[model samples]
Target chain A: MFLNMKTAVAAIALSAMAGSAFARDLVINFDDLNPGPKKGFDDAVALFQKENPDINVIVNINDREAHKTAIRNFLTAEAPDVTSWYPGNRMAPFVDAGLFQPVDDVWEENGFNDDLAAIKPTMSRDGKIWGVPYSYYQWGIYYRKDIFDLLELEEPQTWDELLAACGKMKENGVTPFTIGTKFLWTAAGVFDYLNLRTNGYDVHNALTAGEIKYTDPRIRATFSNWETLINECGFVDNHASMSWQDAIAPFANGDAAMYVMGNFSVDGYKNAGLTEEQIDFMPFPTIDASIPGAEEAPADAFFIPTNAKNVEDAKKFLAFVARPDVQTQWNKTIGQLPINSKADISDDKFIQEGFALLNGASGLAQFFDRDAPAEMAKAGMEGFQEFMLDPSKVDAILERLDTVQAEVYK
Target chain B: MTHAAVPDTTASARPSWVKRNKLAIAPWIFLIPALIFFAIYVVIPIFQSLWLSLYEWNGLYSADGESTATWVGFQNYAKLWDDPNFWTSLRNNLAWLILFMLAVPLGLFIALFLNQTVPGMRFYKSMFFFPFVISQVVVGLIFGWFYNPDFGVVGTLWKAVFCEETTNILGNVTFTCSRPAPDILSSPEWATYGIIAAGLWPQIAYCMILYLTGLNNVAADQIEAARLDGAKGWKMLWYVVVPQLKPATFIAIVVTVIGALRSFDMIAIMTQGGPFGSTNVLSHYMYEVAISEYGERYGYGSSVATVLFGIMLIFISYFLWQMYQDEKGGR
Candidate 1:
């Protein structure tokens, strides 16, 4: 009797597997569970399913942090048809491991070569494009427009004017900047802007790429500028204990006037009860003026795993996501910039300002963490946080970073 | 042929060798299932981790079904010797071990205090046990908010005592303090202690309950005799009650040591080994190096795990030896 039941169960399972195999399924693993990002992704997937009626789409959405660790397992174990991931050095390890399949043909056929030209260099490794970027957003200083207006301060174009404004704000009992270095990456945002402004994009790239030492004179110059900012235009007190969202409290309450942050924080600002009229965005002030500015804009992309079962459907989905209309709709809902140049942007003030800033940049960096190798980025960001907490430890922090860089790059 | 059949029937009727050894074989039959599972899950992974520690792997596999791990012999271990973060994690672990011992005595005192059969004693005991009932993650989060310098209890109290709330230029209410409240979780010197305090809250409750159960088994006649002989307070409790509570104390110390070694969740929830990795214990550091978003160094993490396992093995063997000696003495 047990053997008969077991045979019956095996037959049922086999038929169920056969049923799924014949249906032509496409599996997509997305990493954002936030309301805006999730809604945007769901809407895009829904539209794709509608357009490709024959193919059944199975979507799995995971928390961003959970997805980071899960991708390492799923990409190799049970490869998804398409998966959300970052571009640049963040994708290097998977690319090197032969886990991510190159999608240059998708880009070529979809005309993303010209439309997504800005992110082409970052997405390419070993002279082949590895993924398709759907959306990216700019990183800069988001400040309190009302506070700036009340203090009679214009957007500071240079470092000296920024310090002067900071002094005025401090005199008026307002902190010049607010940041939470608890997670360690917020410090990197500040560091990237400083280094980019101090020595320009090439030096920033060289430093992250391990070609230049952290104790090099040029890098030291950036640290010195950071020290000046620490001494003159101090960040909010006890920032080391707060997350980026927590730091928004001081900004919303007018305890602090400026935040060196990304465009995506607009949602957080709104959630914290700040209106559009109250908050504003500006590019980081120039430090040397000799070196041209390069803005930080990290892109989120999708790749087909090497072992993906539904490669055809995955490529179609990638091309579909890259289309101007799809990207426009997706980024608009998510409050980010579409990678397709032809995609129309919303009338959002921050989006307009970010668009102009990126348009005028000498180059676009993928942020410190995304640009540097993971180990190097981790060590470097920790060093940045240590330096931020205690400016006097600049030499020691830099030396430690030099040691980590040596080990990481080797 | 009839005589041979008769002799065979007589032999079959008698008990066989299998029946004779059934007493010895029954326990082995029952134990085999659990023994197989233990070998597969526990015994195998410990050795696998030890083997993986000698390689330099990023925890990735190639397109083909082959591991991409490269053998680097003792390079990962050699790297740990030079790494400052490893040293910090070791120091924090040592601190956890030393500080966590306080729970035993504190728990004993609380157990003694609550041992009396007074009215509403059960209510008090249950209340004392509340921390243990609540999850460690919740404790970490509660303490994290409590120590916050901006909107937490510390921040609010600091503002009340040292500062006045005033409207800023933008008509937003903000505080101007003589000095800022201490940021405990952000400060390297204080963050570990803050987490340890959170850890101790639940741990003390656990040890208290262990002692409470032990206290119930104490002989009333012996206590009365000790009281008649003027053996009271600390001396009576130390001389009479403690000697009898040795079993409970052993288990408490064992659990506490194991707890100290596995202090990962509190640190993960509270600091993530940050304000620059100052609060990392060995387990959390291992997780950080192997599993975190920026960490894929499986070999390095395994090496650290192996070192942690070695420490745990020593403690476990010592505990086993003590238990063996105790059994011998009892016999």
Candidate 2:
């Protein structure tokens, strides 16, 4: 009787194992837990699960900062089927370590070759596409429309025009631009625009790639223009003490007229009690006018880890995220522009403005921090903050950056 | 035939070796679990970190479970020597160590004041210890806002003295100061001191509680004897009370030294070693170089940790030696 009971237990356990094998588990790790992004991700997952009902989808959402550090450990120790990460040099280390698997086949099969063409170059490394981009947003000058109207200033189109506007605003007892460099990246946004405008896209790429020294004449020219902006435009005082969110106060209160920021800051302005009518977006004004304008648009993407248990389902999810209809619904909920060119955009004024700005741009940079290696980026941003605080120290700051660049890229 | 009887004879002879050495073996038996734990968690990591400091790694591993670290002996240390930021961090650490010592004397004073038998002495004691009960992160955030130059306590005070509020062109009220208010956290010169002041708040409370317990143990007869011999106030404190409070003072100093060395949380919450990395101590700098969003230099970060360990080693060894001497004297 005891022997018969043991056999019965073994049969039941084998059947249970077989039952779970039929409905495969696909685990996805997401970074952002903010309301809008979370909703977008949840909606996309729901749609995927509805179509692939045989697969059991398990989603783990983490705080973005925590996810960044956790990705290194989890990718190796307990790999997820799909994980959210960034594109470009930011993802280079993981790709080099053979932790992230190439999804070139996914891209080819889905015709992302054409739909996600804008971010194709960034997503590809080592002659293979590493991930699929879902959404990206443009970086430009976000200004207070009411403040501009009160000052009777038209959007500046040229370097001289911008300087003249700055002078007029300063004379009216208003700071022309407000920035907080406490976290350091905000200053890099300003630097990327200035460099891209002064020396063009190729120079920006070369500088970040460490192919050119920071003390090179072209880069020095960029610094000269930045110095000119600081001396004349005069960003809000004590900017070094404020975070990007804290800097919004001066702009909202009309003490400052403009901000060099990304599209994501719209929600921040709204939360600070400013209405849509009070604000407007403008492409960073032309500095040289000879160089075609290159705008900053950092993309967020998803990749399959090498140790993933369900490669088939992870690829399915990546392709689903790249679909035009799926991307349209996702980016719409998140207030961002979809990676799929065929995706429909929101009718919101700022979204429309951003879409138009990116559509007409000659090139798109993945921002200073994203384009550059992490070590170089940290030192470079600190130098930019220092220069902003004391423009007279430009020479010393550039020299210091040259030393770091040599050490980092080595 | 004799071998069969030998086993029974040895078992009964001399209580066996283990039974004879019971006093020596029993303590080790009790300590085996803790020693194993300490070896795994504490002792192993120190040597591992030291070994790791000689390599170049980005804190990643290959899919095959091999470390992605490359051996680059002493290169990281040589680089640290040439790096200006390292010097700045070291200087800031020195400043923290010196300023943090003030907590000991200040704590003693507060403990003395609270030790008197007033009407609501227990309530007053709890209130004095309240800062210690709260988390360090909260203290950091409170001080971060307190030092803000726009709407914080310092800013409001500055505005009241030097500025007038007026409506701007877009009809929003703002200040127009004759001279701008001080931005302490933004200025590289002052930011470190601002954070240190915040760290000292809770640390002082901690030291105060330690001394309060010590004060409870102070013999009333000894104090009376000192008083009858013309000892009072500073004389009483220095001659009679302080010698009795040696144990508390030693612990307070040790904790304060460690607290100064690990001054990461306040700087992280307050400025994140910002305004051009002026306020970094070694601990925060090591973390920034290893684990922060931009930092992945594990080998380099380990070298920084090694240097920090070296500094801490000096204090730790001195403390241990002092304890050893006290134990010997007691015997």
Candidate 3:
């Protein structure tokens, strides 16, 4: 009796697998912020659904990091026809393994070269396109304009001006900056920006990709500047225990005068009840007297997986998401700058500034995690956190990161 | 022989009935379902995990564009031998087990305090029992906030009184505390202790609840007899109550040991083995290697998990053997 039941169940399970394995259905599994970025994804899904009604579209939206863990499970169990992922060294291992569908054809077919130059390298792995560029934004300093005016600090134009602003903010009993290193990646924002400003964009990229060691002189210089900011200027109080959201509380209360953050932080500021006039944006100031290039890290992107059941439909979805209307609606909702140059932006001033800087950028480097492989990025970010908490352990931390890189590379 | 059997009477029927032995075979039928359950959930998975530890495959490589695994023999285990993160995790697990054992005695003391049959005793017992009722995630969140050095309640209290001033039990100034109250989560020296302390909050509650139930079963006749023999205070309770509470003490210690070793949620929530990865226990570190932001070192992670499983197995085997001996002695 048990054998009969087991056989019946096995047969049913097999039919379920066989039912969906080769269907023309195009399922796009999206990972974006719920209730906000989700709207953009839904809008795109609606368009694709309308365009191809015959194809069954499955939309699986998950919490951001949860998607990272789930991606592995999905690849084996029931991979979506199309899904989103990041680019850069983050894609290399997967690309090498053939997990992501190469979308060079999509790029060329859509005239991606003529316009989206700023976001090309992000989607490119080993001189070939492995994913489509959905959207990306520039990152920089978000500070309170009213507090800056109160302290008689103009928008910082250079390194000295920035430090002067920090000093003035500190003098008035306001914490100069607020950042939470509890999860360790916020430290990456500060580190990447500093590295980019110090040694230009290429060096930053090379360093993250493990071509340069953490103990390199240029890397040491970045740490020195990071150390100066912590030792003399001071960061927000009790940053080690706070999450990124918790850190926002101090900035929201105006207890802290400035926050070095991504352009995405604008929405958070608006939600925190700060008027538009109170919040303003600026480029991360150049640290050296003379620097080679513009410095900005691009945040958040999308890619199609290699195991996609319907490549043609996946390409169609990718191209559709790249359209101006989609980009405009998506960026506005997420409070980030659109990668598409033709996308119309609203009267939101911070978005305008972010757009301007991103337009004139000499180079666009993918954010630290995207630029570096996952293992290296993990160690690097942890090292940054440790250095911030205790600079004395810099040598040991760097050495450990170097050892991990050595093992992970081969 | 059949022809002879055709002449059967009551005596022949009685012989056939005697050989059947139905009562002796009944228990085997009853044991079959539980045996099958154990075979599937317990035995199969253990062997599978061990076999999987011999090969390298990202849990999701096939979906992402990667393929299946390559067998690496003992290479994964060899790599673990040289990995500093592995050593750090092992040290942290040991620290948790040692420090978290403090809960048993502490819980016993609290249980004794509330043992008095007075007004609102049940209320006090229930209040003391509250921490265990909440889930670990909530406990982790609450403790994470508590350890916040900026605006957390503990942080505020540390700043207000524990900063430089010292007070006696009666609140008189005795001397001054020289050093600052350490930043518990961030400091390498104290991060493990902080997590262990967080774990103890609920664990002590669990132990207290067990002991409370144990104390109810303590014999009043024996206590009165001991009292009549002039046994009182420390000696009386030690000899009488403690002897009666042996069963509870054994279970409490066993749970406390397991709870200490199994502390993963609080550490992950509070610190991701950070401030130089000082707070990593075996479980969190294993997860980190297996699936830390797409870390695809599957064989390596599994080996770490296997080591953790092995250690747990040693303790578990000893415990089972002890139970077996006790059962035999009881028989």
Candidate 4:
């Protein structure tokens, strides 16, 4: 009787194996445990599952920062069919190593070439697109509207105007800018905006790519402007001790007038008790008139791993997510701009302003950290922070950065 | 079949074989699981990290893909010589080692004070032990807030004592101290010291617990004898109490050294080796190079790990040798 039971169990297991073989399963590793992003991802996955009932979808979500370290291990050992990641030079290492599958065909099939054109260069490396950017957000000056009103200050449009506004703000006993550089990346945002404003997008790209030296005259010009800003319009005292969230306290308390930050930080400002009318967004003031304005917009993307067990299903999911409606809904829920131009954006004021700002830009440079190689980015941000803290250290900081740049590029 | 001719002799010898080998075999059988675990988790990884240090790898495709790690020999070590961060990390490590040694005496002092019977002494002991019970990350965070220059206790105290009320540029009231309050974590010169102070809180507690147990085992007769010999206070502690507490002191010193060397968590939580990477010890620096958001230079990180391992090996070897000598003396 026991031998008969064993044979029966084996038969049932064989049938189950056959049943699984007949069905296709796709594993997706998403990185965002926050309510909004998680809901958006889950809803998208549910939609995909409903549309394709035959396909079994397994969704694994993790904390964003944890995912950064976990991806390298998972992509090789237990490869997920699809994984979320950042676009730009961030994905370059994995792409160069051939760990990510090039999904140019999906882009072509979904007509993403036209839709995702703004972020195409970022998502592509070596002439093939490695991932699909689902959402991106513009970085610009987020300023206190009440402070500007109280000081009778017009929103600064030109460098001289900005300097004048900063002078007024300083005269009234306010620090012109508040930033937290403890984590280092906030400093990079300032540097990117300065470089983009001073020398424009091409120089910023060339500099990040190591085609130009840190001590180059153009780069020096950017640093010169930064020094002037630091002297005339000081950041909050003790910025190096604070994180980005911590910096918001002063901004909320009305001690600081402006912050150079991404759209994602708007929620933080609101949560810190600032109302919509109290805060307003502005394009980074122009430094050199000859250089057309280019804003910083870092994008998040998804890729199919090369070792994916179900490539077809992963591609289908990618294509589904790339659709304009899906992109619109997903981005709307996450409060980020969809890469697909046709994707309908939220009527939220900040979203509208970001859309206008990003759309009108001559070019988009991914923020400094995302643009440069990670090692160089780290050193560069540190230099930026040091320069902010002590302007006299500009030359030293730049020289040190040049050394790191040379080492990293080599 | 041949032994059947000498059946009585063979039967007697069979029981003798079991009797002779049982002690030898039994201990090894008991040790097998632990040995297997140690080999897998500890022994193997050390050699693997050493081997990896010889090759340049990004750690992604090197395992299975076409892009294999290139054998770079000792080039990673060569690069380390030129790397300023490495030197800074080494210096900071030395600082951690030297500063961390203070915990041993501090622990012993606290233990001695608590050894006396007093009102609610047990409660006081537990309260003193609180820092050690809490995780290092929490201690780092608590100290981080405590040291904040704006709203923290230190900042508030400084402002109250030394500053006048002034409005900032944005028309908000804030303190403008006559002498700017030191932002400890933000200053490269002070950041390491600040983190080390946070680390010492729990470490001192740990040492206190060790010494407390040792103090419980202290012989009453010996103390009386020392008192009869007119050895009291410092003299009693120096000649009698400390001598009896040698084992606890040794263990305390060994653990403190190891803790100092592995001082990554507090630094990671408190400063992240920042304000220009000033607080970095070798382990944190190794992590920054290998796997932090900065970049992955696995070969270089492995080289750093190898150097750290070498430093630790010296201490561990000395400790083992001392133990061996003590064992031999006991025999």
Could you say which candidate leads in DockQ?
Answer: 2
Residue lDDT tens for model 1, B1-331? 9988987997878768888789999999999999999999999998999999999889988776578899999999999999999999999999999999989999999999998889999999999999999999999999999998878898889999998989987887888889879999999999999999999999999999999999989888998999999999899999999998999999999999999999998999999999899999999999999988888999999999999999999999999999999999999
Write the residue-wise lDDT of candidate 4 on A1-410 in tens digits. Answer: 35324433543454354454327767788899899998898788767766776676777777899899999888888898999999878988888787899999999988899988888888889999888888889999999999999889999999999999999988877779999999999999999999999999999999999999999999999999998888888798899999999999989988888999999999999999899999999999998899988999998888999899999999998888878999999999999998788989999888999999999888888888889999899888888877887889888888988888888889
For residues B222-245, what per-residue lDDT tens digits would candidate 2 score against the true structure?
A: 999988899998989998999999
Model 1, residue pairs in steric clash: none
Q: Model 4 residue A315 lDDT?
A: 90
Selected candidate, larger TM-score, 1 vs 2: 1
Stretch of 10 with least lDDT, candidate 4 chain B: B59-68
- lDDT of model 3, residue A30: 69
Q: Rank the candidates by lDDT, best first.
A: 2, 1, 4, 3
Model 4, CA-based lDDT: 0.89
List of chain B TM-scores, one per candidate: 0.95, 0.95, 0.85, 0.94
> How do the residues B234-262 of candidate 3 rate in per-residue lDDT, one tens digit apiece?
99878999989988998898898888778
RMSD of candidate 4 to the truth, in angstroms, is 5.1
Residue ranges of candidate 2 with Cα displaced over 4 Å: A1-24, B1-13
Per-candidate TM-score against the hidden true structure? 0.94, 0.94, 0.89, 0.93
lDDT: which is higher, 3 or 4? 4
lDDT of each: 0.91, 0.92, 0.77, 0.89
On lDDT, the stronger of 1 and 3 is 1
Look at candidate 4 and tell me the lDDT of residue B241. Answer: 91
